[model samples]
Target: MAVVLLLVSPASQALDKARMDAAVKAHLALFSTDDIVEERFAQRASAVDLDGDGVEEILFMATARCVGANFDCPNELVVLAATAGAPGQAGKRLEPDVLAAAQTGYGLAGSEQIPGEVQAVRVLKGTIEIAFLAQQDSPVCKRSFSTDQGRQATTHCPAPGRHTWTYRWSRGKLTKVSS
Candidate 1:
């Protein structure tokens, strides 16, 4: 098993809870309740300099839960860039084409090209790394087979591996560097 460590950049340290709360408040209508927004923020939000600017921007990996999950749930990469106002003001939404591309998945190891679920995102050395869980079509053995001596044969399902997509930030844009 491979483990990827998440390292927070110095810029991210500037991101405080007050600013995050304000950002969530600005988009409250998107979620069902305040709790969902808080849950997503606590779990998936990351702060990094998406643009070349020195200030850090909030990159929230919002899931379908943000809205009512009545149908297919799609993940969204929400970017909140700092607005010129109060010192602790929330940022304005900045949607770039690269953000959509970041969500797109390349094929996993020894498998067909399938969309992997976004698991984590982090900023490291001026690049963005997004981790995904690659889904595999493995068989699930519900019932155990009887052995020669009446011993039960237990079966287990394989765990999904993490697939990472690396993106480089340049000239106020994100370009896929590797998968």
Candidate 2:
């Protein structure tokens, strides 16, 4: 659990809470409430100089619940980023392309391109290092969606290797590093 507190502004108190709420909501939107384990998502966050402008950016990740008969959910790895701001503005989502990258199975060790699971997030040397685990034996990120008209199901094949990949912050985005 990362507790981030930087040189906060007077309005930062409200801004931080608002950003956290938005992140949680974004995570919730990834899956149906019944499939989401509300307790898995926490308010823990990381504050760092993601852009190196003398201000700290807020970062967090959310996980989905694999409940009942479902193997996995889109709730696996959702990372949110927010910049410093006053009252009603400044906190914004920094990563949506991550989902696309994961869906394509970008940096897997084998043919399984499904992205890996986030195991840890640490800020070191002024950079955010996110470690992902390819838990081959466990359920990966198989996302299902339900809409007003109907529902869609996608099953990501299980990975063959229990390997790992580390993605680092590059220009405000998580770029998967070669393992």
Write candidate 2's Cα lDDT for 48-99 as tens digits.
5555554444555545445553455433333444423232224644355434
Model 2 misplaced stretches (Cα beyond 4 Å): 1-32, 35-40, 68-71, 75-79, 83-118, 141-162
* Candidate 2 lDDT for residue 124: 66
* Top TM-score hit: 1
Q: What is the per-residue lDDT of model 1 for residues 1-179, given as tens digits with 9 covering 90 to 100? A: 99999787854446666666556444423333443322322236655666656677666654533333222233445555554433321464434432232222110011011135666777887777777774453121112344577746443322456778777665545567887
Model 1 TM-score relative to the real fold:
0.47
What TM-score does candidate 2 get on C-alpha atoms?
Answer: 0.46
lDDT of each: 0.48, 0.46
Q: How close is each model in CA RMSD to the real structure?
A: 15.3, 11.6
Poorest stretch of ten by lDDT in candidate 2: 104-113
TM-score of every prediction relative to native: 0.47, 0.46
